[model samples]
Target: MGHGTENGVGRRAVLRGGLAASGALLVPATVAAPALALSGRPTATSGVQSGDVTATGGLVWVRSDRPARMVVETSATGSFRNARRWTGPLVGPDTDFTGVTRLHGLPPGEQIHYRVLLADPHDPRRTGEPVTGTFRTTPQSRRSGVRFVWSGDLAGQGWGINPDIGGYRIFDAMGALDPDFFLCSGDNIYADGPIAATQALPDGSAYRNVTTVEKSKVAETLAEFRGNFRYNLLDGNLRRFNAQVPSIIQWDDHEVRNNWYPGEVIAASDPRYTEKSVDVLATRARRAFSEYFPVSTLRPASDGRVNRVLRQGPLLDVFVLDMRTYRNANSPDDQAHDPQGILGREQLEWLKRELARSRAVWKVIAADMPIGLVVPDTTEGLPNIEAVAQGDPGAPLGRELQIAELLRFVKHRRITGTVWLTADVHHTSAQHYQPSRAAFTDFEPFWEFVSGPLNAGAFPASALDGTFGPERVFVKAPTASNVSPAEGYQFFGEVDIDGHSGDLTVRLREQDGSVLFTKVLRPGLVGQ
Candidate 1:
């Protein structure tokens, strides 16, 4: 089968079988746009992105409208007159025509410009218009400062691509910040939330979604799951933001369904996916996620989980946790001794070892869900199960035990400058967890900053569990659902690390580019 040719196979078959012909080939520079235009296939519709940046390299991503041989040219200048060329993986039907190029040997702490060129996969003689992007590699010196933004929840609760309003304009606002990278905390897509072309607004106005056949229903098949990732790219603002700002992306429950776990079965109440197993759905979702995001962390480990660490220079180390992959089913009766608590044994051990071994001045835990927040899973007509916690006001219980153990380990290891950043709560808050205020005081004090719902419903603040000693320092939440970004509650967090002093500054900002709260902590003053 030729690349871009859709054989009569179903979506799942295409996903599984299309990778058989992924042979890497070089393209000639003589390839021109006119020749590709004759093929009548759309080129790069989703725009281009660069991500997973390290001191010496980064990953560049692009999605072609058809199967194509991907090429990336990098230069220090915006003009690619003397650029270095690199070949990306073959983009075929297996990955929904999306591919990532690993750009290595880049100069650290310097702005690097790149252009993505797609040629005919079979011919390699016809080319499409090149998409341009720029990113800076991590600084090799610990004396260089670092800045990045973090947020989550895209197209959730029926808030999807609105072409009329320029599709997720918050991204444009975030882009203006000019951060080095974006840490997508979780809920990158809502495969469970089907979007209609037109939705009725509260004031009798109509909100329009740039809908496709794939996004009109809950995602089940591989193609539908891939469509969930494609749906956001329809937004020009998101595309523009992605081009300039690299991303460190992760996923939470909504990537498959709200609060779904490994063994849960789809219920009949959800007409779109009745009687389906969530694990099967997650398999499809995970593949689509890995295909779309540029992060190598999406590649599963030997144990089939996506938990890893990213250390940028000696200033900061990010421990990205995979809370969804190894979690037990949500239930109120989850016990402290349960082996299937959120992080799983293997991942938790890896995290501890990574943290203790790190020499960076700052250790930021990129948690998909907050430690103390009460996340209730009311799916499948089941009683409200504690997805991450049981909301107990006393000692650690259930999943809390796992978190407590991790915290105690950190304390015992004397891992200073350790902080937590999370997003699943749909609000922005600054939380201070002090041992003196906790029922269990074995752990050292730390700060947890919560911000999210890049384009989704605004929710009220979740109640904190007393087990971990979380005290809300500052909170910005909405009382209603489906709140538009225009209302200005949509949030993203920013972190800036000073190289010379090793001071970290955290800022929570609103969708309108206004700062809601700011805090600066020096190296030795973490718990204070």
Candidate 2:
């Protein structure tokens, strides 16, 4: 049942030593190269990644340069000797040679070592080199602490994979923290920004990107959108990080275009997009996103909804929302009705029900867009196309009406330890909403933390809507265009929840892993 020889070692000992059972058999530098060289087979270009982990199972993802068969081997021990083999779907041109395999029937709260093997499409006997990855399942007991990281906006605003500086080095910084998993808040890729081989910096120096023909133009077709995902895998750091940290990914506007609504028509003046209809382009983008990431819940449903709940043992419950799919057109004059809001009636009801039923200590709303931020689109002129807000700082209007209702429900239900984590504004900030300071103060006090632009242009802060009485506790943003990671403004957020005390610590970190701000919250401490 196992492919490799077994080593006599316990899983706990292996994890405590920070080494896998397979580590003893392979050299770190030559693992991928020597194995493929000996077999004369095409190796995986994007390495291996594991994600969407539960107590019993998880998903593993890989991308090959050519058509191949996806095979995965998992073991309780690191040596992977006597590991259970799971044959996955075909990795073919239909999915841009990327595929994911689900691993099931594993023990909870234990380290699972896995290797990804790609077999020849025609000859199953011939296999490529194996890429190794490890992930720990969610703890079954309520006594174990949980930690995870989150961020958004990858490769945006003309920022691309730069070989000279090591592409997206911030991922490396995040990976070093060794969290349980990574939650990609949104904007996994920038389909609207074209990447060039060389980008001139504001300092008059040239910043180089490892560009491809598909990335040179704005993504339109399905192939182009898939290429955007493949392009980010070119970086060795990202590939290594993906292998180590399993991801829970969600999408935002840049995954298709900038602040695009569902049924909007592309303006002819924008030369980059030739697809007149934005929905058509979003369909292509959504398919590519599903194929590339290991999130199993991203499957296309009949109603076109992608909202789901991710429960990590008894510690945390993450409700991933689909903000883009059912949203109305961005307009200030829109009515304050539930059907015409950001989260439609159906989704809002589901969120409330899930929050009320959740037994986890912390209830996290993984919103792609911020609540109070004033995001306006003036391309069509006049009162401005507002995505989530009507820009009225005083009262709830347009999309804010739905959000206000949700907040009120939380207060009525007396839900404690509920926090919001979002990334879309391409900056990092900590906001505290107090009933006393807000215009409409029916809900209990809560916190919202924003961090983003994994590698993108940084912008100024957005004005907050006063409907929730949000106060800016902390803020950090770059004053320049297309800021690089070396500038040290790029940010990510980490949440660590202690099982014993039920205390939650939220830390906002810079690109270099330095903490920008830290907040600690205890259970039943709402409005404190």
lDDT of 2 by residue, 204-263 (tens): 887676676678788999988887887777676777778777888888887888777889
**Weakest lDDT window of 10 consecutive positions for candidate 1:** 11-20
What are the runs in model 1 whose C-alpha is more than 4 Å off? 1-42, 299-305
Global lDDT scores for all candidate models: 0.79, 0.78
Q: Using Cα atoms with residue i matched to residue i, what is each candidate's TM-score against the true structure?
A: 0.90, 0.90
Measured on C-alpha atoms, candidate 1 has an lDDT of 0.79
